[model samples]
Target: MLELKTPQEIAAMRTTGAFIAELLDDLQARAAVGVNLLDLEYRARALIEDRGAVSCYWDYAPSFGRGPFRNVICLSVNDAVLHGLPHDYTLRDGDLLSMDIAVSIDGWVADSARSLIVGTPRPQDQRLIEATERALEAAIAAALPGGRLGDISAAIGAVADEYGYPVNTDFGGHGLGRTMHEDPHVSNRGRAGRGLVLRPGLTLALEPWFAQGTSKIVYDPDGWTLRSADGSRTAHSEHTIAVTEGAPQVLTRSLTGAGLP
Candidate 1:
């Protein structure tokens, strides 16, 4: 069911959102070459503990997930896109890394993800990451009051299409609140005037993940990490947003802060 958050609930959710954003910023700085994905998970757990927030991913057993997600955060590298289980793998030079995190504070939850290139980035690799960020920005911008869900989806799709990248329709964004996943599955592509109507106090995570070549993806042998079927590089960016009377408010925003590049 789509639960409209009360003003008090939204305020508490903002705290969780800030933590999500701050952790992503910290992870972005720490995801250097030679860092183990497990190390990142450890740091995330500590940070959550410090803030007294509960990780929404850890011990999370969902219908689509394999048993319980054993880590505090998701670490996707290179071809790996979503639901990446952190392991003993060490990040190498020019490796593309995606960190997805979700946490609950005062019973409200917020989720977000970001993709970055470790060490030096190649030209094409940089472009892929940039496209994902642009798509995310477009989607967030479209999440305004009176706007339709399709508007947000179309905005994200337009950016991906402009970059000549195919859309990955299998997994997209969705409503988030008391629980991690909620109502209104938000896809990366859709008609601009259809689907759910945007309203004040409705919070959603708008994510845009794209592969450099094709949209087709396959699950890793681990049954979690999603990777491009063609083994091409991928990028993903997301933000938890609240539809407001003013412009949409970005809850899970990163330190890169203002406008997209």
Candidate 2:
């Protein structure tokens, strides 16, 4: 069922979103060359505890992945794009790393993801990252009352096509609230003005992810990491937002800065 958030529920989500946003920012800053993926995970675990929050990914036994996620955040490097399980690998120069996290505060949840290059970045990888960022921005802009969900998906597909990257629809954005996943799955590719109608109070996690080479992805033996099938690089960008009368409110974005709000 597609549930619309009441004002109070929305406010609670905003607080959760704020914590997640700041945590992501902190992890990004700390993911430098020589840093281990598990190190980042531990940091996120501590931060979540500091806020009296809970990690939605912990003990998340989804149908597709291995049982009991047991991690606070997802760390995908290079060819890996989604559902990555953190390990002992240390960051290297020019490595494209994606971090995804979802946390609950006072029973409200917000999810967000970001891809970046550790140390120096390769030109092609940088472009791929920018493509997802642009696509995410476009998708956010399309989340307006009186619009359809397809508008957001179309915006993402258009940007990926403009960048000549293929999109894999197996996993994409989704509606989230009290729990992690919810109704109205948001595909990365769709026709404009199609699917469910958008209205105020609807909160969604709009994500755009792509591979530099092929759209096909293969699962790791770990049963969680999703990597490019053709050994190509990948990137992912996401934001949890709410449809509003004016511009959509980016809940997972900083509310106290010129860059956000």
Candidate 3:
């Protein structure tokens, strides 16, 4: 069932979203060359503990996942894209990394993801990250009242298409509120005026992920990490947004307006 958050609930979500934004910003800064992926998870766990928040990924056991995901954060490096399981690998210079996180604060949940280059960035890697960022912004802009879910999906697809990237519809955005995932699955590609009707109080996590070479993906033996079939680098960007009477409220934006990129 589709659940619409009340104004009060949205306020609560804003708090959680802000915390996630700040956390991501801090994590991104600490994700330098030579940093271990497991270390990133530990840092995220400590932050969650300090804030008295709960990690949505810690016990997450979706059907597609291996079992309960024991990590506090996802660390997708280079060819790895979504649902990345943190392992004992050290980041290297020029490595393209993507992090996805979700946390619950005071019963409200917020989810977001970002992709960045560890040190010296390659031109193609930079372009992939930028494309996903722009796609995320476009989707958020389309999350206004009176719009349809497809509007957001179409907006995301348009940006990826413009960059000549193929859209992977296997896993996309989803309704979000008290839980980490909910109804109204938002695809990365769709017609502009179709799907569920948008309204006030509707909150969603809009994520756009794409690969440089092909749309096909291969699952890791760990049963959590997802990688590009062609060994091409990929990027993903996401933000939690709420539909309002006017412009959509981007809850996952940092205090300084820093966001996915």
Candidate 4:
């Protein structure tokens, strides 16, 4: 349907994004070496409850997912990129952790994801994380009014190509509003001039994920977690943005301007 937000609706969405940004930051600060993954998940739930926000992942049922998701956030570890169901695993030093979360506030929804190292970071892992972050920034820059949706995808692809990382377009970004997913699916790679035309008030979640090795992905038997097919490290970065008359507005960044410099 390619839904576009009204000015008032856009403002509401920004409010939701602010809460999400703060929540992600808090969760990251709390996650560390020797911390239990389930503990982080619980913290997310508590914050969401306190703020009266609704988790987009809870009770979420899709064709590919096993059943209704029962978690408030996804905690993906090394070699795991997306849809990671938090378990009782304890974090170790140098472990790569990716956190993805989506929430609805006052009927508006925002989604974002980030990857980081638990304690001491590996140089290669740091590079991989930077690659996804750069790709995310490039995609955000390409999301301008009147620009084709492909422009955003192409920007992400170009960054990935430059970084020598293979991209998997199977599970990329998408539109979101009252619900978490919407029309005009956004892939990680595409022709710059193709796809839907961008317009003011168009909101999207732009995500770019890459694997150090093959572009293929493998699913866990739990039917919720997805990891790199070759067991290579992976990274992902994302933000919810809005297309305006001028530069795109990144709604999912923290108040400290934590996104691109």
Candidate 5:
């Protein structure tokens, strides 16, 4: 079912969203050459714990993921895009890394993701990240009340297409509220008028995940991480937003204010 949030609920969700936003800011700053992915997970856990927040990823048993995901955050590097399980791998210079995080405050959940170059970013890599960021912004801009879910989808697709990047819709955004995942699954590409209609209190995550060469993705042997099938570079950006009386409210927004949250 597609869940709608009450004004009070939305306010509560904002806390979860803001906390997640701040945690990501700290984590991204700490991610650098020679840093361990597991260390990122630890930092996320500490942040959540210090704030008395609960991690939605851990203890989450979605069909596509393994039971009780061991890590508090996703640490995807290079070809890896989503559901990146933290491992013993250490980030190196020029490594394109994506960190995905979700948390619940007083039972309200918010999710977000970001991609960055570990060190000495390459031009092509920077371009990919920038494109994904712009695409995410466009999608969020289309998420206002009275718009359809497809409007968001089309906006994101247009940006990706303009850059000649392939969209990976298999793991796009979705409705989020008391739980992390909800109804009315939001794809990365769709017709402008298709799918559910946006309305006041309708909260959803608008994420644009793309690959330089192909749209297809494959799960790693761990049954959690998702990677590009063509071994090409990949990027993903996302924000959890709410369709309000006028414009949409981005809950999981970045500190930079460039994303809808």
Candidate 6:
């Protein structure tokens, strides 16, 4: 069931969103070449603890996930896309990395993700990251009150198509509030005027992820990481948004002034 947020609830979510945005910014700064993936997880844990925030991924055990996520954040490198389990791998130059994190602050939840190239970046890798970010922006613009959910999905898909990337509906966005995931699954592709109606107080985590070569993906042996079946690079971008009376509000905009790459 979709639960709308009250004014007070939205206020609390704004705080949670700010924390998540700052956390992602800090993580992106530390995710340089030669940094181990496990180190990134540790950094996230420390930051969450310092802020007295609870990690939504630490013990998350969804139907599709392995036992418990057991990590504070997700670290996907190169071919890996979603649900990436951080391990002992060190980031390398020109490597495309995606980081996803969700946290609860004072009982409110906010989730966001960003993809960046560690050290030097290849031209195509930069383009992939830009494409995902552009798709996310388009989705946010379409998330206005009275608009249908499909409008958001179609906006994202249109941007992806313009970049010559195939849409993957296996995993996408969702409603977010007191929990990390909730009602109203937001797909990356859909009809322009279909699906649920958008209204005020409808908060959603809008995400757009794409693989460079193909839309198909395979699960890693770890039971969590999802990699491209064709060994192509992937990029993901996300933000927690609120449908308002006019333009939708992006709750998770980075506090560092460094927008998505």
**Per-residue lDDT for 52-150 in model 4, tens only?**
999999999998889899999999999999999999999999999999999999999999999999999999999999999999999999999888999
Model 3 alpha-carbon miss at residue 119, Å: 0.5
Model 2 agreement with the true structure over 28-70: per-residue lDDT tens digits: 8899999999999999998999889999999999898978899
The list of candidate 1 runs beyond 4 A from truth reads 254-261
Q: Looking at model 1, which ten-residue stretch has the lowest summed lDDT?
A: 252-261
Model 3: weakest 10-residue lDDT segment is 252-261
lDDT of 3 by residue, 171-222 (tens): 9999999899999899999999898999999999999999999999999999
Q: Look at candidate 3 and tell me the lDDT of residue 165.
A: 97
lDDT of 1 by residue, 35-154 (tens): 999899988998899888999988888767667888889888888889999999999999999888999998889999988899999999899989999999999889888989999999
- Cα distance off (Å), candidate 2, residue 247: 1.8
lDDT of each: 0.88, 0.92, 0.93, 0.92, 0.87, 0.91
Candidate 6: lDDT of 67?
A: 88
TM-scores, all candidates, are 0.95, 0.97, 0.97, 0.97, 0.95, 0.96
Error of 1 at 12 (Å): 1.2
Q: Tell me model 3's lDDT, rounded to 2 decimals.
A: 0.93
For model 5, what is the alpha-carbon lDDT of residue 142?
92
Better of 1 and 3 by TM-score: 3
Residue ranges of candidate 6 with Cα displaced over 4 Å: 255-261
The per-residue C-alpha lDDT of model 2 at residue 180 equals 94
- Candidate 5 backbone overlaps, count: 3
What residue runs in model 4 are displaced by over 4 Å at the alpha carbon? 256-261
Cand. 2 Cα-lDDT: 0.92
Clashes of each: 0, 0, 0, 0, 3, 0
Task: Tell me the deviation in Å of residue 43 in model 4.
Answer: 0.3
- Estimate candidate 6's alpha-carbon lDDT, on a 0 to 1 scale: 0.91
